[model samples]
Target: MSSDLWSFALNVYARPGVEDACLRLQTAGANVCLLLCGLWLEQRAVTCDEQRVSLLRTLTEPWDAEVVQPLRTLRMQWKTRAVDDAVLKGMREQIKSHELEAERALLSRLEGVAQAWARNAAGSTTWLEELAGAAASPNRDALQVLRVAATGT
Candidate 1:
């Protein structure tokens, strides 16, 4: 992985099976940006705790709901219609780009906050599991695939 969260996210997300796994988790209501942040933190050996989790969520929820979600919803709403309408297609593509930028901004924010945290003697592995807590039960295999790719274990 890379030292910076955004670079690490780009690398890990491009790994085989990771995109699909992330999509599954996303559909299951997991925040992919938060999950990516978890991977970055775990890679850095940051200790996982309720306070940190709470802090990250506090920072993320509003941004995700206010910024990313609206753009994603607009894009998704146009998915099929955009296939037949050229103008809608262009607008939808723009929405997709905006959604991506929003996510990137969120990841940057997450990195900024998490950078102050300390790393442990042993690399902590609870990040993804804890971050994905709600989605874990229903998306076990998908989560495992993400874990394996992120940790290479």
Candidate 2:
């Protein structure tokens, strides 16, 4: 796995089925940032426990709510107008870039929090399940698909 959070995110996100599974989880009210963090921790063999989950949520929820989501909303809202206006399209792209940077920052924060928990133990699907537990109305099957795609189990 890449040492940099952004590079790790890009590689994991590019895996087969990961994007769709993430979208599905996001649609069901999961914070995609937290889910991605869970994947990153799992990749690093960090032991997933309730305390770690709580710490990650405490750190990320506010950032996602305040920064990432609003930028994403604005970018999506401009999609139709951007198609017809080059200037608007450029602005939209800038917003998208900011949103991505926000996500990268969140991932970096998560990595910092998990640094002490890193281990040589084999990764497990438990973190994904625990993280998804708070999702408003998660799709179990979709979560399972993500587990397989992310962990190859």
Candidate 1 backbone collisions, by pair: none
The list of candidate 1 runs beyond 4 A from truth reads: none
| Candidate 2 residue pairs in clash (backbone atoms < 3 Å) | none
* TM of each candidate vs. truth: 0.95, 0.87
Q: Candidate 2: which stretches are off by over 4 Å?
A: 120-124, 134-138, 151-153
Give the per-residue lDDT of model 1 (tens digit) for 18-136: 99999999988899999999988887888999999999999999999999999999899899999999999999988999999999999999999999898878868888878987897
Candidate achieving the largest lDDT:
1
RMSD of each: 1.5, 2.4
Q: lDDT (CA) for every model shown? A: 0.89, 0.79
Q: lDDT by residue for model 2 over 35-121, one digit each (tens)?
A: 777776777777788888899889988999999999999999999999999999999999999999999899889878887775766
